[model samples]
Target chain A: MDDYRELKPEDLVEDPAFRAWVYHGTGAEAWNEWVNEHPDHAQAADLARNILASVRGELDSFPGSEVKNRVQRILESLDAGRSGTHPADRSANHRDRRLWWQAAAAGLVLAAGLGALIYTRLPEAPAEKKSVAFVRAPGTSDQTHLEIVNDSESPRLVNLPDGSSVLLKRASGIRFPRQFAVAKREVELSGEAFFEVKKNPEHPFFVYAGQMVTRVIGTSFTIRSYQSDATAKIRVKTGKVSVWAAETVLTASQEPSTGIQELVLEPNQQAEFSRSDLKFALLENDRPEVAPIPIEQMSFEFRRTAVSDVFEAIRTAYQVDIRYDAGLLRRCSVTASLGDEPLTEKLNMICEVIGATYREKNGKIYIEAGGCE
Target chain B: MRPKLILQEDPVSPLWQLLCSGDKDAFGQITENCYKPLYHYGTKFTDDRELIKDCLQDLFLDIWEKRAHLSGVANPRPYLFQAFRNNLLRRTRRVSRFSEIGAEDELEFSSFSYEAEWIHRETEAGLEQKLQLVMKQLPKRQREALYLRYYENLTYEEIADVMGLRRQAVANYLQYGIQKLRDYWQQVVISLVLLLAS
Candidate 1:
């Protein structure tokens, strides 16, 4: 309606009422009359409208059911919270009772697994269902846990926020905090689940299956602790791993007493901790074909390469820290054909000829030698 | 993030009134009607679907709890828009453990992807591409204004309220935003010149 004599394409685009007039039939007759009278500016007005119209891409059309379901959940949670009947209430009584119930449930599932492998037909779209299980990490008294269960008849895949993937077997469940624990990445496993962990050295991942705790730097492995089975097992598919048994806790203040012997397992190796004796032992993996590929890909074939470069490559490949006297090892150069051997074998093969002795402590590979000279 | 425009801008006056009077059915209707748009709008600011869902849940809960002290708004779209923007700004900042959430919080704006919107539109084959690139190059504030104006079709005052800017500022942002888009031709010219120089 204002004078359109000096309006640039940009000016026309900026004008809301003008854009409305152009696109939404706002003052269409008056704008048409003005455009007919002033022929030169019509193109700019049209261009401005085109750009404005194109600026609005189709918005995402979400299914209404998702919104309704979400609203219903919030309303239900609010109602429960008002009635002091929230299931995830952090009271001591609630926590202890829930813990007892889960523990009993875990035992029942384990027992049931042995009796009936009821692989019921998986529910349609199993990923969409939210788990009702709320688990809290053992050490952190305050944070709530994000628990996921594979209730379907078949395996269900879960992707964690930290890039870890879990293939949870039917009737299996895992629980970790919504955000990982500050000191460590810890999750509790009740049944069988295969974890493909993206390694973060600072946040060492721990999987507490029943009373046995399996620790790793970064690797793919499966842990099994069905309710009927007295032994919890950890099989390392890649990278270095250590496992130790922790005494089961019945009280709140119980710490995982460290006096139990810790056993380190190499690739293609498995460890089982007997729940009765609370002892862990290393054994060869039942399946050797699958574990060798990761080891082969992480091969160290150094031809006329500096020892430091070799160690650097190895360190980067495995996400393990190799603490050698950089000053001492910098001068040393060695050539070796390292194949798809487990981490320990490769270290031993490289160190045997180089006069270096390697030992692992706290998940780090330490190379000790006099000197290259 | 261009939310799918809910074409149903039907007079929501009755629903708003019913909701303000503590009607749960009206609340459900509002959620069903607005959830997609709100979700799509939230996605513009963050790709965290969980965060988006959480913000929406919090937004509806807060409104429901405080429905007792509310005024009746005829067109509830703008009110809901304002509430969503405020709720998302507060929650996202607090989620990041911000010490204090202030006016600067709304500065966490969503960006537009023009390619997603690119239609054959009978323009030159790659004209849409150039336009998209130029649009993305606009300043975030200007883009916010343009989005509110063009996408949400908000008036200058409504945009001012949602963006927490003055009416004048909103006007300036729209002017500058479009000017920036129009400058894409100049950019194309400069690129041609550079190509010739090379």
Candidate 2:
């Protein structure tokens, strides 16, 4: 520490260490010890101390509530700029991610490959979300519905109280009770989400997305019901899924009107509902062309392999089931190297060789043939 | 008197994850939670509420647009502060708007004012007044560095980040700023004492 014995009041404040001592209440040991050890410099040290003390004071800042209101407006506008839907290509990419949403939700841990697309499914209605009410007494509510939204580019992992997990997509949201009720594990969703639900026969898992409600005993599936989307969809990756249009609730007094439809979906099946018509259809999922299959599993090189064996290999590679009787195909064999061909083309060639016909039913491919007599 | 509730600064919180993950509500909470501190910092530049608001709005929109690319950070408060400062400076530079009102630098940060709820002693009120005047006369960058250090309670490194200066530069600013305040206070006191004696 420099001797303050000769240093003036102005010179004292110029030292970074002295200023640190004054403001931060630190770096004063050497200076104070030096002053105490030498009484002659006490007067000058005292004068320097007085100058530093008088210069410090409190500064008033803007009111919190006013700035908070202004900032809220800014954030809302930011949300609208990016998530109020996007250009056609971007929307399609987000829309297509719906398939992966199911597979990923099924606890498969699939790759969220198309993460760059700005996926937005705005609710048609300007929701008077009770965000403020929730904030006002966050501590008071014992079972308040906890809402979570993945507004990021990639999927976010959400652990549910019931031991299930959700892989929420970007610009998507889910609201669930803080604790799953004993009766049911109910959660509401907006936009797109994939769920990997815990199996509890005593309590069924339910997801309410827009005008559609999906119930599962225990399984993984994806739901797409962006408020602004013209069509709402539900795709099952595994296990049985039961879905019903929420029109029944909207058209009160009409018990199960013809307008209300319920559909059951199995693995590799998708249910699409049009908002304008209030009607839904079950369709076989289009083959996941973009699904990342392992390089080694990409080729179908079967040499004198049983027809059943061929189907088994396809199932392992594509995660799609091909239903066929092993008994009828006991004598059937095939020798062909199918490389990079479309799934349908490969299936066609195999079915022709085995003298069997194939048809898609509920996302499953079924094969039938008169026993090889 | 400053309201404690309004002046509350957020600790490093989960708000960062929520914001980076594209949660609109998280964005809303952040605005409501950190706006006062941010506004307090912005007004140090200029008191025009509208301009500050506009700049803040633009900053937030930019954050949301690039949410996908943003790193999942734990504490983004400093980053927000830096962004607000940069935006305000950039906008003010374009028109030299606030400076036209006073002879202060175009990007002048508002120095400590005496009318504020000062915590100085009754005996040192006059000294405080003189100190305030000295503060106003300090260079803009020095004033900013002092504000970030003593006022915001930011570390030397954090102040450097906000001011876009090296840590050494920030240390020098504080040193020079305090020195100037002490010198001016002495001069004003000596002149006052002499006038009284006459």
Steric collisions counted per model: 5, 5
Which regions in candidate 1 have their CA more than 4 angstroms from the true location? A1-46, A53-61, A72-373, B1-10, B72-75, B98-107, B114-137, B185-198
Q: Which ten residues in a row have the lowest lDDT in candidate 2 chain B?
A: B114-123
Off by over 4 Å in 2: A1-61, A82-373, B1-10, B72-75, B97-104, B115-137, B183-198
Q: On residues B1-198, what C-alpha lDDT tens digit does candidate 1 reach at each position?
A: 101222444544568778788998887777667776677677666544666676777777777778777655655777888889778777667765653444354345653532223121213447656656665666676766777788667789888887788999988877766666556533432332333233
Q: What are the per-residue Cα lDDT tens digits for candidate 1 across A200-297?
A: 89988777665566778777777877644557777776677777654331111112333557777776677777765668877654564222323223
Interface C-alpha RMSD, model 1 = 18.6
The local distance difference test score of each candidate is 0.58, 0.57
Q: List pairs with backbone clashes in candidate 1.
A: A59-B3, A59-B4, A110-A227, A110-A228, A111-A228
Each candidate's TM vs. the true structure?
0.37, 0.35
DockQ of candidate model 2 = 0.08
Q: What is the lDDT of residue B54 in candidate 2?
A: 65
